[model samples]
Target: MRLVRAGRRAFTGNADVLADDDHRAQVTDYFADLVRPFGAGPVTDLSGQSYGEMAKALVAEVVPAAEPVDLLVLAFSIHDVWPGRATATYLSHVCPGTPMSFAVCDQGSASPFTGLRVIGDYGVRRALLVVVEQGALPYESAAATPLAHRGVAMLYEEGAGTRATEVRQYPDVVPEAVPELARRGVAELSTGHPGARVVLSDSLAAVWPDHPDHTRVPAGQPMTGVWWHLAGASEDAVLVGDYDRDLRYLCFAVVAADQSSVD
Candidate 1:
């Protein structure tokens, strides 16, 4: 299937608070202007509402009204799913009237891509994919990384926009095999678009080395990679997201349009 339109909403974060002057350079290799933060401050509290509520509302707003959605697939990180927030209830609230609805959870950053495959396997012609993540609590000093509330929506249909050629997940990857695995993954996708770029997820960013057309932007959330590809980056690119080193599962999405039409 292909994406028709996409939108992203990031709450309460700015690009001015990098830990060091060299952080940006180390991130993208392009001398990025600013690093976007997803943690505390005025920007994070834009709607003066709860992250989950605002995120669901944003999904309702960003999804194209003109499109006919047959399926609603909601993706969330472990941080978003909590006690009392039943998935079925939220689905009804955010995507009422859809004939079918489902959720992808526990995959961390790989859930969104899994959602895409779900649509394809179910033969749904039109679908809505939503992913949301919230920042770690202010007092949670044990948090691995500063979290931010973020959400993204994408409208997908059978035959329009940028097509996703291949979406595959690998299991039990060894550290010794990452370089070769990454190289082979990129090489396979590059066959069609020789100039395609690489967008590495947060999991693989530190270990993956830079290459021509390589752009590293840590996915604050699972589906954030799709958001970045749709909102920024080259139209033809490869997205690599690894869920866990121990679980060793890696997900890759190769996006490209008709090569003849691509410039």
Candidate 2:
């Protein structure tokens, strides 16, 4: 499948549009009991963007109505404030073709890579991949939240003479072993694609082998960092990667520009 188009949006301030008395009470109670063991206080803030809302906006912008997708995948790491809602199911109804939609999460930043790989495995004629990150947490935690809300939507279709994406992931990759493993992965993915640009998440860049053309994704937006950069890449062939420190998964994808769609 080839990536034909992509679009992204960033949200700031309060996301109070979806907030309601019942939703807030439920979210507050759920988080309160969950964090009580850690001595964390009750959830006082429930202002955050709904993944459904964000993904819907992105779908409308990137995927044309005439070109209905066969599949839609939503990937995220941070929990949405509106947690109880079945976001992926909601998206399927709104998106064209009423595609088979689902969300991938709990694997940290590897979620998107996993989602992309799933789409390829499905052998669909067309697909949509939505990656999103939100910035709010009702209770305090060890994990860092995104600085802002962001979402990216990519349109992929079966076609020739377009940029194709191939995803690879390695699990339980400790920091000490990342350099060697990443170097080998990059080398394999870059083979025959001369001048392929390498884009790495900040954590990956620190341990990655020295490369003259590699670019580092900015910090703060862990889940969306690499994908956000991928949307803006101008290279004909590019390799984007990220290492999830908490989850210990190293994920990468090579986008081969001018390559025929891979079946």
Say which candidate scores most in TM-score: 2
* True-vs-predicted CA distance for residue 235, candidate 1, Å: 2.2
For 1-263, candidate 1 gives per-residue lDDT tens digits of 66555667776642332333463233332212122243322222111114346456666665545555788787775433232356535664556344377778877677777887787788777777777666643222343532566777766667644446467666677766666677777677667656655667666755555433456666455446545554444354445445456456666666543333322
Model 2 collision count: 0
Q: Rate residue 136 of model 1 by lDDT.
A: 46
**What lDDT does each candidate get?**
0.57, 0.83
TM-score of candidate 2 on Cα atoms, chains taken together: 0.91
- Candidate 2 per-residue C-alpha lDDT over 188-251 given as tens digits, one digit per residue, 9 for 90 to 100: 7777566878889988887666643678888899989888877777676778889988889998
- Which 10 residues in a row give candidate 1 its minimum summed lDDT? 40-49
Residue pairs with backbone atoms closer than 3 Å in model 1 (clashes): 12-43, 12-44, 109-222
Runs in model 1 lying further than 4 Å from the true structure: 13-52, 96-99, 137-141, 160-163, 210-212, 219-226, 234-243, 257-263
Can you list the residue pairs that collide in candidate 2?
none
